[model samples]
Target: MLEEEYQPRRELPPHLRKAPAPEAPFSYELRDAVLADMPAVREIYNYYVANSTVTFDEDRKSLREWKSKFTYLQKLGMPFIVAEAPSGQLLGYALVSPWKQKRAYRFTVENSIYLGPAATGKGLGRVLLGELIDRSKAAGLKEMIAVIADQGAESSVALHEKFGFTEVGRMGRVGYKFERWLGTVMLQRSLK
Candidate 1:
């Protein structure tokens, strides 16, 4: 796990934090996520965990925990990237990791994505996912899948469809939060 004291400075400009308008191009660059991205990544993720159903966990995670997660992904040789604006502010990030630890499941991986609040509805998620899929395919993964919260919107479903992923299954009431239950949806895209 990465140390809690780890805080890598993003080597980009500073004006990128401006609130995005309806049509500012929503420009972003897809690049490998470095140690410097942990703070922004943690901010985006914690917001979701606390206010949205994107993930099932209830307790808010600490920076140390996020660092450990990044460390784990690095150790697994997984592909992780941050979507950044011209000034280096992070828009979002995506990654592919093993779906299961069993050797039989090594050929398959699951996908995850999180975008900054201001960056939503700007199409950055789609671009980030496209880059991630290309990298995963080039890495020789046989299949890539997404496990999304059942209550997720059509945009998410459509994004996967645009990339050739189709609904594989759904688990009812698999997650409980905000005083309610939510379903889990699984979708997959084949690289082979």
Candidate 2:
């Protein structure tokens, strides 16, 4: 568990670009995910699936299937965790998985984080990600990658950068969503 600490960044996304102050983050819990958390975890991810191309998951998973997904991550020894409010409401979830299926790519993992729609902009992403990076390092992972969906996906890309992730690649117009073509940005952070 991490105690409250704040470090404001100079660059912020357009929506939050000119805000005069940072919001106080709520007290939250971060812990490894159990099978029972799939429902709430899926609920958090479902919003992005329906509204944005942040995730390419066109079809959402049922609890049974989601459990399988979690099981697979466990088999790979990847970390899957959630952030929750003091009242036990899930605020967000994050995990690291194989960056690629090949054996040579084993040392690198792709990271994903989804804050509850109402929970965005609270600086909790940094808190969860800070811990995520720590855990990955402890697990002996060498690198972590983030394949963010679009140039406009600045908040997430910036979050990664804040945690020492650097932009490694960009492929334009790689995905079609909401009747528009979107670009993909790849960012990397070393765990060593």
Per-residue alpha-carbon lDDT of candidate 1 for residues 125-177, written as tens digits (9 for 90 to 100): 88889888888888788899898888865678789889999999999998899
lDDT of each: 0.87, 0.87
Per-candidate RMSD, Å: 14.3, 12.7
TM-score between candidate 1 and the true structure:
0.84
Model 2 lDDT at residue 22: 78
Off by over 4 Å in 2: 1-25
Q: In each prediction, how many residue pairs overlap at the backbone (N, C-alpha, C within less than 3 A)?
A: 0, 0
Clashing pairs in 1: none
Candidate 2 TM-score, true structure as reference: 0.84
